[model samples]
Target: MKQLLFVLAFVATGLFASSQGAVKKYRVGIFASLYLDSTFTGSTYKFTNQMPKHILPGLDFVQGALMAVDSVNSNQPLEVMVYDLRSADQSLDKLRSRNTFDSLDLMIGSVSGAEYRTLADLALLKNIPFVSATFPNDGGVTNNPFTIIVNSTLPAHCEAIYNFIMRSNPTANLVYVRRKGTQEDRLASYFAKYNKGSNGSTLLKWKTLNLNDNFTQTDLIPHLDSLKTNVLICGSLDEAFGLNLVNVAQKIYKTYPMELVGMPTWDGMKDLTKPEYKDLSLFYTATFFNTGTVAATNFTKGFTDLTNGRPSDVAYRGYELTRFFIQLLLRYNTQLMQHLNERTYRSFTEFDFRPVLNSTSGKPDYFENKRIYILKRSNNLVSRMN
Candidate 1:
């Protein structure tokens, strides 16, 4: 789903430089993929102001970005350029050939697969900070210091889960419950990375509980212990698997003393408020979370006034990222990446973009937001665990 990332390539020519206090005019590119062709029928440029569903994600993102641009209290000319990926006039290939974003200083996107690879290469070649907005995987691009993946990866999620589990009683029974899938293998491996050579032998007592798609309460209950708190780590990226697992767990949770840990993808299933999930305390990881703040309240009010609808999570991300990065541009300019860890410009959600190094050169392969939030949902209420 994160493929065809509607990227907003905010640019500034040549160094995009500015002194500590002094500022100059800069150009910002909003490279979004609106899929405009699907919006209309036959050959017609005429379109209504109302947005189609296909373009809502990109539109919401761009709206938040534009709002952020307007919010920045700067007199300097920060030119905003928006590009539609599916448009004939500004398609990805067309814009690339035209060198529209060749001199970009930073690119914020949720791009993945071939598109992500292409954009990451371009950012590396041009020395632009490619900020991947929500693509969880890196797409195997390495040795490029300019790449910044905002979403925490699977391994990062696993690590967060492991760390959270370790906080419980070391004698607690840890079950890596999952279905038969290739991704499940990777999840198990990631858990093994932390489980191996740590905390003296198996004080945490780890075990694998492989379940089928039609797994029932009996399939899970046998592995769980009544004495120790049963920590069931749902080791599948599949939502169906997670839902099925939850359905089963919720039935047997009262007897087992359960704490169900879920994959990062579980963050998307918003309707966990159903009665089935209430008795069971479900845990998942996310890169973004807002308990609500003054700044967030202001943004929500401004966005509702601007769009006449509630802003999406992506919209908030766009605003927070754009606002924070622009502050960096104003403060450090071309040296933005040099001081990415600077605590000066804080966003509503915390971002910890740590460097991932290349094995050969020992240099930064790319940067990734290693900060993962473990969230809990219980009794139709959700809260951050860490």
Candidate 2:
């Protein structure tokens, strides 16, 4: 049991607990769905070699948070407690009932779906600032003032995409291409709202092209233009659908001239850099961007040295999120939410946290980082678009 609990890192505060009563101690909880039950076999921990696929994100998050905590040069005692959401003895509800969250000042999570909702509830109940690290959707959480969604939601992505296209080429032949699905319908509706303004005027006209799962070049070529750049925006987050659209567009790009734009989910997709997908330009939006500064470079190097492999973008996000929030927690103390918009604690990306208010109550539902970056990929390289 002790060994299993060790799996959840009890990140030590630098130096011992100070004897002086004047020092204010800060504590943070790193919550992640690291399924430790799969490895704990009758009081014996197995799998000393390869970690399970599902565990990597949580593991990476923990490692990155550790790096941030270790890098802190403050004497202020900052203890980080990692909670495994899937742990049998320490599940979310169990810990919440045991008054675990009451001990922490902040909560950061890489969890989504049910786990996200649970954490949000806990945050609201305890009045602790909760950072939703990776989950884009708010998990239907409402009226939770403490919830801070780090990843921009689907509506936010849609707004970014619409604004980007409108800015670049409002008159350009814009075609919204998507697959037949429920999510596709929701994305389409969001796109339509942008086009159909409140004054009953169409700001921009775009043709919607619906394609099946087995769609080919014949299905996409008809909506594209041959004379000028046919701006094709993929409305679906389905990776398969997105790849097919790009591949089809790539075949006729020389003749039809395509400017490909994809959903925010395409930010970290390595498939877009394949040799076959080269030469064709692709644009996408992301809430987080790794600026690769001196700090970022050192983090990458240090991460590789520790893990003996390169860290994923999530790891970088974890490092930045933890570092920034922890610093803010120490500085502002109980007044952290009041200073959320202060751009002083610059990390890998600039965060613009604004209050999301309820329509009727006119009260904050939650705070969300509205800052999004429009990025471009061309010639096998990805960069921020001006």
Candidate 3:
């Protein structure tokens, strides 16, 4: 009878252990500059002093995505810990003092370039995955095996813009107008390469304009009047310069018609809709959500319902990032870490993070949703060109 009791006790203990093991929990760390001052109240502002009250819709979007995933997967309760890194006085020391890094399975944020570098180092040391919802400005977190960029980089954007222009106007002459900064210069070089063999022959021309000193309509007016090209590409994000370019192009369009093309920075700028830019018919490239497709529309509605109708770029990014990660987790199950290292998530982007080495000579790779939208500005209204 004692032997029988011992066997039963062992069986009960094993069942309890199994049940406990099935209820696994995960903690995700969200480090961001969400605590901005109330002085800058707008859709783009990332921070506020109101505790959980005035936090932007982007935060809600991210939190909602995590919550939705957690609701269905009760086995693993995901606990998201947020770090408000918005103050100018904020430092890595404060982040370390919080001891928030101790139990983190993954880290996501739109930290400053410097803070991103620090977080990259910490993530590598801790062996945790890191995702950046915004552009980090420092050419991505290199050497960090666990870091993933949710937003497409500047180079990818440039490539997409180049391809779209080449396809749309095979015979059109292309002229690139750029500033003298590192980012601008890099894009200029990229355009040079693409224009060399982009279409049948080299039909693109390059022109450099000093954005600091000699950046006025007068400087580009002569070129515009003389050029046979009708398409003009601006490689700078300076809103002031963009406005000037648009103004100049509009004036020149009276006699010489031209099309202004820019990168993703052209989106959401209220200044572009002013009367001065009315004649500047602009075309630019943006991500899938910005294009307003059926899938994107449904997702946006779902996101708006969760966040009280406040939306922005970060909100869309958070939704897509969370959805992608959740899909990856469900598909790979326990082998997520392994599969990530092996570059298995090809559907996420055309260029899988793992298989594609970040080099120039490899496949003409681009991020997964390379669907570029040609946005045209007609009568100061922006619409997607079909």
For 1-386, candidate 3 gives per-residue lDDT tens digits of 12222322232122111123545546556565544433234333322333344445435544434433433343444455545465343446775776768766666666657777778778778877666556524345444556665455666678778777877765554556776777677777777676676455775444555555346666666665444546778888776666667767777776666788887787766778777777667887655435566646766676566544555666556555554554455455444445543333222222234322447555312122234455777786678764
TM-score for each of the candidates:
0.89, 0.92, 0.69
lDDT of 2 by residue, 1-386 (tens): 23322444332212212233656678788888666677657556567665567777777787787778777767677777777777776687787788878788999999899989988988898899999999999788888899999898998889888999999989888998988889999999998887787888999988988878778888877777788778999999999889888888778889988789999979868788899988998999998777778888999998888777678778887898888898899889889999887776666778888888988888888899888899999998888975
Per residue, candidate 1 scores C-alpha lDDT tens digits across 1-386 of 11112222222112222233344556555556666556535433334555557667877777777668777876554655665665687765776898967655567764567777877888888877777776888889889998888887888889888888888545677788888889899888888778776654543567888888889988887788888688888889889888888888878877889888999888889657787678788898999998799888899998888666898898898888877777777667778898877776665888788898888999988898988898998888889887
Model 2: lDDT of residue 13: 14
Off by over 4 Å in 2: 1-22, 40-45
Residue pairs clashing, model 3: 34-47, 36-47, 349-368, 350-368
lDDT score of residue 59 within candidate 2: 70
Off-target runs (Cα >4 Å) in candidate 1 are 1-24, 40-51, 198-203
The better-scoring model by lDDT among 2 and 3 is 2
For all candidates, what are the clash counts? 3, 0, 4
Listed per candidate, the RMSD to the true structure in angstroms reads 4.7, 3.0, 11.0
**Candidate 2: clashing pairs of residues:** none
C-alpha lDDT of all candidate models, in order: 0.75, 0.82, 0.57
TM-score of 2: 0.92
Give me the overall lDDT of model 2. 0.82
